[model samples]
Target: MKLKKLMTILLTTVITTAVLTGCGQQENAKDAQKKPLKVATNATFVPFEFKGDGDSDYKGYEVDMIRAVGRVMGRDIEFNNIPFSGIIPIIQSGDMDVAASGMTITKERAGKVLFAAPFYESKLVILTNKNSGIKSVEDLKNHSVAVQMGTTAADYAQNLGLKTKQFDHNAEALMELKIGGSDAVIADKPVADYYVATEGKGEDVVIPIPDSKKEYLAFAMNAKNKDLQKEINAAIAKLKETGEFQQIYKKWFNVDPGDLPKTAEETLQ
Candidate 1:
């Protein structure tokens, strides 16, 4: 009887260990199935993407929006800070899955990548120190202008025949404006406002250039990723219906998003 009791205890311990090991393996298998969705961004645009103090992680409106979108799709998110100019090429090469760095939707870009629904509306603005005489796009004709490279503002400035200096980051361009390296900084309105507010340069001026063309911001993915684009579109619509998108906008801009497009195609029209 003593021998039989000892044998039974040993058998119980072996079975328990096997069951626990099997359960752990199943959990790890589940974790392994979750593929990460890689996103590329430029972290210099405040209120859109920027790094926090002492940390390399990016934090901003676009970061939060993409994470939320990932949760809805049941995918893990990985964000990479790539140069804004190279974001599309990175997506095209499959090194990254998506680009969400406050990219404007243009016919040219749309031809290269599939754009998700427009998340925000933006326009070009000129930021100058109070003493700078630059007030409009017309005023920039003879002055040295600074713009972030690979951005619509840069293109706009160049097309205007102005002598332009392109910088890697909008902050650097704004700094050039502050130090008189450039007569004016042409950038997205939101970024210009963010710089002015944070730098305590309230005395600086912002001049909005009226264009019949309205620019909308959206996420970009490779042209071949149609299924992923559909998923993203549905996710955006759900977020809008649930008011989650509005909450995100309000958190970042402190104002309502107003009327947003119901679908990605609507933004183009």
Candidate 2:
């Protein structure tokens, strides 16, 4: 009977240990799955990401889009404001997990980072005051142009030999044109249109730059994080497939986005 009692005590001890071990593993899995992601975005672009109309926190298309991506990623995201020029570097340094600042994905940039599927289709255009006497792209010559620093628009303006005035944000560049500090502002078509619609008060005009090519915008991650990039790509795909993305697109663009890139490679457009 003494031997039997000792055996029974040992069996109970082993069983309890097993149960506790299983519970600890389960808790660890939950903790691992609940880790939050950090995102970098420049919020000075209208209709994309911007300081709220009064809310302070971000309130724009990319803000809603990134949050949706986070939901599909099964992680909460903390959006941080980095300068547009610093976003890529921050991602490269692994300090940021994502970049979604109306960033245009190009071969040069894609070579440095892992790009998810494109979320927005865009083009560059010229923005000027309505009475600035600039009716066409050709008329922009010999005039100073304001541009958001480090943007394709600035590159385009410089390549064309225009006097370039670079600012850190689109709002500031547009303001330069508004106050007659610059002859015009070259920016993304949608951004120029958004400003004209919301605050231009019939004083601004958007003109297409002839021969401008289409540009695609996507969330970028550090090249080392392929798994995270896959997760982000899946999030974008799922959002588009379920029609949730369209609702958000229409909210800002006033029209359907139709479709976005289906895969990472397709985003190269």
Using lDDT as the measure, the top candidate is: 2
Scored against the true structure, residue 22 in model 2 reaches a CA lDDT of 100
Worst 10 residues of 1 by lDDT: 260-269
Best by TM-score: 2
What is candidate 1's lDDT per residue for 104-204, written digit by digit as tens? 98878888899998888888888888777776778788899999998899889888888999988766787788887988888888888887788735768
Between which residue pairs do clashes occur in model 1? none
Q: For candidate 1, what's the RMSD?
A: 7.3
| Root-mean-square deviation of candidate 2 | 3.6
The estimated TM-scores of all candidates read: 0.85, 0.88
Worst 10 residues of 2 by lDDT: 260-269
Q: Which digits, one per residue and each the tens of the lDDT, describe model 2 over residues 13-80?
A: 99999999999999997896578778899989998999965777888898899999999878897989
Cα error, candidate 1, residue 48 (Å): 0.3
